[model samples]
Target: MGNLSVGKADSIPTRPKRPLKPILSDAKNVPRRRIGKSHKGRIALLHAIAHIELNAIDLAWDLIARFSNPSLPNDFYSDWLEVAVDEARHFTLVSKRLSELNTAYGDFAAHDGLWEAAIDTKDNLVSRLAIIPLVMEARGLDVTPGMISKFRAVKDYRSADILDIIYSEEIKHVKVGYSWFMFACASMGLEPKNTWQECLKKFYKGNLKPPFNIKARNLADLPQSWYI
Candidate 1:
């Protein structure tokens, strides 16, 4: 539902009773900023990451709610719940950083690209796992190091430290997704690699950009052979 909230005290629903929509501009319409050494540029960078962390919080909850199935093991729910908590923490940290910069999450327009990917695979958990974690979150592993370096270069050690925490935890999140996606594929009598490739071709519209973080991805159990 439009008013759904996954607060700490909120109960997880069996499934969404109606369509849920979030208010955000399209990706193309959102303004892009060059994350330079300027204060405003740093604000813009942190603001964008905060927006992503906020969306990640919703995404973890949505995955649990939208695809609730009694047949699945309890570990599935537990994994996603942990992911939701991590996302919330990430959002809080980013928000604090933004506040320190004299800005906030909604101070700039943000694109709903992450949630759009969720919508694309809402009906299929396999596709959802493939696109969200393998493609999107894995991409985070690729780029987050550069973002950390950017902050450190500007001597914004506080922001860089926050990003360091996120970068480490995100690997575990991707591992959760990869593990469950393989589980789903096995349950369906499908080949994991081929099925993942098929899901990308069918549901995802973007390419897997390279210079990938092969080491981090491998640590997460996502081998380059699957995507590259």
Candidate 2:
């Protein structure tokens, strides 16, 4: 329960994800920019999806690693462990389907935007949950239906189906974030809603930009009363 007892992950007080080398991943062997849309497009998209899942792996594990403290209840590690497992499942599902699509992870260029948020929040768990699951991953929940439609429109049934499952599960994941965020605030005797907006402003340097899904934010238990 020591402040310094987070396990297994390379500790970082700043830029926790600066070195997401994916040492356990062989995605580098996968080809980049394969051709022909017959299955190539599906392959590329799934490749990107796999990359996301990979980043999610580190993100969840680091939660356990960076925040294993007496401030957290005994159950906190188990919750983050569950997240790690779920993200593993997601990566496997997308990777398997990507093979079916005739490509694999690293078969296309991808960004590390998701992990950037992870690094940004390494200073505190409340701010971590606020940005990771609430702001960023919550957006994943909001746009999933459209992703399904786009996949459907292109007739990639397997891709569409996989995305559907990820969509449904992501909601529960964000709910996990909301639950812990409130718990942290309540346990620390801080105002949950006020801290939420304050953290958002502090992290993003002001109001969150447009294209925000207020509905999904509400679903994540970010009540409108919290807006600054």
Candidate 3:
């Protein structure tokens, strides 16, 4: 019976061999600050965000498939699956906006940094949750408002509207990650703040850029004391 659970190991879900593309490249080479107050620059910005959302879809599913844990309650699966759905919707909405601009996802080069975070933390569910949703998704919370403002400044209400929706929903996604990470820490009798800090030091190889959205992060239960 290969179908049987072997002493509590959950069946591992298969990983996608490759991400849906715009030809992955180094983050350094990715065109930076393309969100200038111009039509072409706006298109570049949307393409970049669409790329992140597409990778987000895969990353959510990858977490479910790569880190299946039978002992963990069903809520964990439910959380990530729900996140996957949200990310899918986000990708669809942004891609539609790209279509409106007579453009699509592959029109520009994108950094592999997001998926790289997923790959690096694939081995540990805790690190994966910490790095992906908490660290990565949390970064979205930090930067999105500026994007929304940028779009509004250029009178691109349609794109701004879409980003508004994503900004709201992403708060919940980050909350889910924070909740799960805290749950894991409690299970192992570790302090949440200390353990999270340690994980960031060990697993996240990059520094968190400042000018953070402290208020939004506070809403998600990630206090400044932990990061600062």
Candidate 4:
């Protein structure tokens, strides 16, 4: 597991536990963000984002452990490991912010959809890359600036600053996914854009809500045509 060049799907845990709070539940059951208007709502929003980061950490590692492609370059593992580190940092930053608000993670209910996305795409690396990074994390690009603004609007500059950092780093994470997805597509002789569309049609369970961050997505090398 320590060696990036060596990988075995069976060697890693199928599900790893973390110290997340408030217990996992259905997505519909989790509180919606009215994060700017009230203290408790803000706490709920942070808790939810923390839960997301924690799952993201697991997702990065899980991608490494679940994929057994011998043709995958060593840098694939390194990239995901870097993503895992970023997610861990994100979790710690958000958790610390939560504590500053006299709250903690697991103090609010969180949805399990992210892990479900992982499970659904586990059998295919292309689909995994499409759904998790392209669709899901890309959604982050769409929404995060507004979250930053919301935090700033309420004068929660500390929280806004943390989100600013996360937002910037996540673009690189998406680029890593985009690069690897293209690699896998080329290896299989499949057109990258078409295969991406096919994967999204097959495995993605939701629509991409609009008002997209075209600039951010472009920065990540994901063109507007991919989403629209």
Clashing pairs for model 4 are 21-106, 22-106
Winner on lDDT (1 vs 3): 1
Over 1-228, each residue of candidate 1 has an lDDT whose tens digit, in order, gives: 233333232454433332232236776655565567788878877877887888788888888877777677777778899999999999999999989888777877777778778888887889999999988999999999998998899899999999999999999999999999999999989899999999989988868899999999999999778988
**Deviation in angstroms for 70 in model 4?**
3.0
Once model 4 is optimally superposed onto the true structure by TM-score, how far is the C-alpha of residue 153 displaced, in angstroms?
Answer: 0.6
Candidate 2's C-alpha runs over 4 A off are 1-41, 205-219, 224-228
Model 1, residue 66: C-alpha shift (Å): 1.1
Question: Model 3 clash pairs?
Answer: none
Q: Write the per-residue lDDT of candidate 3 for residues 1-228, one digit (tens) a residue.
A: 224342333655344555466777887766664666666888878888898898888988777667666777777777888999999999999999999989888877898788777777877878888888889899999999999998888788999999999999999999989999988888778888888788799888879988899988998988789877
Please write out the lDDT profile of model 2 over residues 1-228, one tens digit for every residue: 235344444554543443333333334644353323466555665776787788888888778878777557756777777878888899999989877766666545676667767878887889998888877777677667776887788677777888888877777788888899999888878888778877787775445545555676666666666542
TM-score of each: 0.89, 0.78, 0.90, 0.94
Tell me which of candidates 1 and 4 scores higher on lDDT: 4
Judge candidate 2 against the unseen true structure and give its global Cα lDDT, from 0 to 1.
0.72
Candidate 1 lDDT (Cα, whole model)? Answer: 0.84
**RMSD of every prediction:** 5.5, 5.6, 3.5, 1.8
lDDT at residue 167 of model 3 (Cα atoms) = 98
The candidates, ranked best first by lDDT, are 4, 1, 3, 2
Candidate 4, residues 1-228, lDDT tens digits: the string is 356357476666656776656677887889877866578778888888999899999999888878856778888888998999999999999999999999888787888888888888888888999889999999999999999999999998999999999999999999999998998888888898888899888888767789999999999999788778
